[model samples]
Target: MTNSKLLEQFRSFYFRNFPDDMETQINYFSIFGGLGWDVDTSKPLTQLIEELILQNFDTLNEKIEQLTLNEPNNKRLLSALAVGDRKIFSAFKRAGLNNGNGGGALNYLQEKGIVQIEYSRESEANKISKHRISHKVLFTYPFIRFWFYFIYPHIREIKEKNYNKLFKSIQNKQNSYTSLVFEELSEVLLNYNLRDAQIISSGSYWDANMEIDILTVTDKMEIYVAECKWTNHRVNKSELHKLEEKCLKLGIKPFQIILFSKRGFSNELKSMQSKDLALYSSDNFEALLKNALNSTLIKSFIN
Candidate 1:
């Protein structure tokens, strides 16, 4: 239901049914996973969208209309949140709302479990000012985000049985859009691997100046700082250095610096792996395919 544990559950369900290579599974899951539906990954996502969504337009509209109380403002806000950065201020800005009205609409959505606000916490020991650290507004499910991002934006075009705009937006934006899903699943993978660790907390870390994709701390005070590079190029020493610089500024002496990429690491970084450094490519995600391992994930990690 809620994304509190939604990413992990969708991933589990996907691997169970799709039975594809890691790359194919992740690519399709980014667009279609969060609705608890059985997706036919053989079809292109655009075809699937036409078959499942465009043909079923009135049905979806009825469903969302019920959820949003038929308010255009709420729909506008949801579309903006999905298409843009998850920053709270940016969502309101893109939706063209002042705080009072926008804040009320956000509260209503939060109450309905459609979205939630997550604040960036400053390290108590840091000297940096905390005021500029931004909060994010995230959808409760990936499918809802996908709908708003691709379908909701062009409902009028879709109404005329035209799909050109929808298809174009997806083709152009898919990689960047799916990058967020990859990052989410990367966190899920981390939590699964560290199932035995006494993890105190885990998620994205941000301050005024920088955002770190994956940061996990254990009860032993061990910190793992990671970057998920969902790109085509192999990761190198330079990526590692960037993470190091951010940690240095935050005074975070991590137990390990982890890097995950779609493409594997360079020979230089590969040789540099040690107790304090780790590199992961999508191939490493094959670990998530084990039913025995994931069945106990939330139970082990959550209170």
Candidate 2:
């Protein structure tokens, strides 16, 4: 579940001595993981960001600017990818870079260990599809991504302490903004929930046209496709239908189509659940924190 060393480090550090429940920690971690201080997870993120992030903007900005070596090209690419869909073409378009430049910039970012690429899975049933799906560029750390998306582009407002626009944007778009992190953590939770099977490969899947939020393969050749809904509304049958449609278009018969909703499923959707149709809510995400570090446990060992 902690797929990369950086992520493992983050989890260990973020959850070290001060601990909260899974949902509480995840909400704070998505926006403020890299901070040195232990965030008050009980407080709403809006208040915390205003008090912590906006107040300390200059210090945080300087550190990240140094990461890019004060290069406009790198900054532009990162901020673009941070706010945009993160597909290669979308990143270039957002950054206004030509293909050659975009490729060079991407290479530079990757070399610096700031971002990682996830290539689309095989889509065609029989042969390679002519359509070339672009790989997604993801930030190595959640905090960097958070900064680029929320702070980098709006430096003027932030510097002056004009938070009206920043707060407005966060209020309106925070759910969508947090979905990517939520989706990533949900994948980890799934693996934690299902430990018996040997996972061959696991990630989001995409083709020329459609995308599935999660696609996992097991050593036994079982396929699991899933949709993650991080919205206020409870999921319904239509959402499941959409996921099934994506699997059908990709010409793969999944062993099960899973649904992970932040809000619980609708009564209609709940009635439809079975072995082939699985469902989970944020409560299920506690699985991701199995064997979490405990300061008391460590003290006992040391003693």
Candidate 3:
């Protein structure tokens, strides 16, 4: 299928099968969803999911082999990437690869569409300059991200047929693994749901000292700074204060501060919500999706 058509299919299937609950949705898709799998609803869910995961694992192995053959160090670069949700060129260098070689490998992966670059847009002054810009590398898909993060490092165990160890490792890190996906979903919500603000630039911002989960600048020069939490507990005032402190340290006076939580907010934060502060839960994400659909339909009618 064409790339656009494949993406449309992926989106339709994802939205239909995986709804608002971020953790549960990612868990379901990590096993049962992919490009070529024929999901059999009649089969036992556990049995079907196991089979789908194995099928994806086999496909991933094939891709790894191809990538390694194309570039001997590609697997190493991927291993470094799988270490976390995102990293810069220096991270790979520190992972023991030569800096020049690591950069080349990253460039190759980006060219091959295996990795994506999140170009930093932190405004130093009034004008944003292209020179001295840095970026973080991320896996382009959730399945790939999961595989690399949890499975690829344990290839030796898989080759020796020690599946139990791999399963245990994945189980231990499952929550941490899905948190990155939650952050990406938060970005989508911000893009679609921000009131009166047209996003001119948006992404995670980081430096040597700290990192902000979500940051955006609107066409009108208003800044929206946000933090995303994928925890089971409600977000509290301390977390909001931390975001406020970070923005202050960066010399940014945000027009709005957004707190996105999977489990809603604490009473203190809920009481403090106002025009300048916004709290979003999983339910708000569902509403954002509905709003997006309605907006699309209205645009179609107007066009």
**lDDT by residue for model 3 (64-109), tens:** 6675554657777776776643566655764567768788888888
RMSD of 1: 4.3
lDDT (Cα, tens digit) per residue for candidate 1, span 1-303: 113365565555555556466776777767666555566778877888878778888877777788889887788899888888788777888999878878888999999888887666665565365464557876766777888888898888988988898899998988888788788778878877788888878888876778899898989999988999887788899999999999998778999989988888999999999989988888787777676444432221111
Tell me how many residue pairs clash in candidate 2. Answer: 0
For model 3, what is the error of residue 303's alpha carbon versus the real structure, in angstroms, after optimal superposition? 33
In terms of TM-score, how similar is model 2 to the real structure?
A: 0.89
Superposed by TM-score, candidate 3 places the C-alpha of residue 75 at a distance from the truth, in angstroms, of 1.6
Every candidate's lDDT: 0.78, 0.76, 0.65
State the lDDT at 107 in candidate 3. Answer: 81
lDDT tens string, model 2, 1-303?
325443453465456524466556666767775455557777788888977777777777777777787888888999999999889988898899978988888899899778999876654563355665678987877778888898887878888888888788788888888789878877776776567999888988766566788888899999988888889889999998888878778778999889988888999999988899999887776555456655121111001
User: Order the candidates by lDDT, highest first — what do you get?
Assistant: 1, 2, 3
The segments of candidate 1 whose C-alpha lies over 4 angstroms from its true place after superposition are 1-4, 123-130, 292-303
Better of 2 and 3 by TM-score: 2
Alpha-carbon runs more than 4 Å astray in model 2: 5-10, 13-21, 123-130, 295-303
Question: Compared to the true structure, candidate 1 yields what TM-score?
Answer: 0.88
TM-scores for all candidates: the values are 0.88, 0.89, 0.80
Instruction: Output the number of the TM-score-best candidate.
Output: 2
